[model samples]
Target: MNGTIHNRDKFLNQIASRLNRPRISSKIQKPKWKYQPQHEVYKDATQDELLAVLEEHCKKIHTDIFTTDLQGLPAVVNDVVANCGGGPVVTWKDERFSEWGLDSVMKKEWPSQQIDVFEWDHTLGEENIDKAENANVGITISEITLAESGTVVLFSDKDKGRTVSFLPKASIMLIPKSTLVPRMTQAAVKMREVYQKTGHVASCINFITGPSNSADIELNLVVGVHGPIKATYIVVNDL
Candidate 1:
């Protein structure tokens, strides 16, 4: 049912013929770099130490950060949702919501407060995009947390649409403590491991750091122009 037809092979052949080369790919060998400082920074930091780095970076990025345990996550989520102007909230249909007791909050607490909840249902098609567009807040669980840049990685799939995080005015990302990595270097290695072992990974992986902001106008900083203006990161300590 895909409407766009790709003449990729023909295009590659044209270039290959012009260059007098075979249209064949060879195995790529790892480059020997003179220096790899990427692996050297925060090389021996523990989870707590990494958390400290994440916190420091979060401050600079103008993101609110909090830490809690499994038992306290529900409360934290409630507080954050309310702070961010309790929804019309859109979220991924992730099982972690139920596992982490957030499902109850969405179903019960928010309803009692007259807040609307919209979960991305794959069957609904483009309706999911509309929901995200109308929602005040969007919530998601971070698959990987990077301390170096204070970033949260969201792996997009059918149930986790890109618009869920992109279209909302405010966003909240939940992080399990164990998912924290020292930096993108470690995060990329984990992703490569997934691809090597499974032969595939998520189609779109997003690395979000705080709210969307730009200083393009007269060097004046403005937030929420392209995406959410408010961003929150809640790290579950004992998850």
Candidate 2:
């Protein structure tokens, strides 16, 4: 410990000497100003228009988009799962799924499907990750959906790990209409509000536009190379 401390001090002193200043032990204050851009696009679209834009962009990016009312969400989810070949499914432990009646619906509709819910206790970390990695389908809830980019914002927490979305062969996100925003700026503002209320932010905030794709290898496009090959968004309209 003493040697490590001495080395750290020597490193800091060398930098301080080069700058001709003494070492300081103070935290830098973050900027407080909000810079509003002069021109903002897609800011005044009606709800219907925003949905149309989202659908168009999603299709362009090769993301499968489905719309349903609250009552029909269960059926939509069932269809998505069925289309994925009746998966061994992994899901985040979110209360919203239960509130939306998805938990019961899955039990009834997909009796043979193996469903695993992730738990973040220390002992279960590796086991949970393995389950997610092996699962055919992974389902998650989108905190916010940016219509301008057709992107969904996912905040990773104990319940929702980063692997839940990236590891599976197919990923499904449940997005409520009320959570849709016009642009990335609006999504960031909502994230800030969440931080302010919770006094903390998640470790990972993923903005996913579509399935993982790369066109860099010999200019040949490949999908799902680094992540899920297929992505689906179930937009709940009557949320």
The number of the candidate with the highest TM-score is: 1
RMSD of 1: 2.8
What TM-score does candidate 1 reach? 0.89
- Candidate 1 lDDT, tens digit per residue, 1-239? 44886998899899999999888777889899999999998999999999999999999999999999888888999999889878899999998889888877899888888899988999999999999999999998898899999999999999999898879999999888898899989999999998999988998999999999999999999999899999999998853
Runs with alpha carbons beyond 4 Å of true place in candidate 2? 1-39, 112-123
Task: Compute the lDDT of residue 190 as modeled in candidate 2.
Answer: 89
lDDT of each: 0.91, 0.82
Return the lDDT, model 1, position 167: 92
Deviation in Å, model 1, residue 172 alpha carbon: 0.3
The prediction achieving the highest lDDT against the true structure is 1
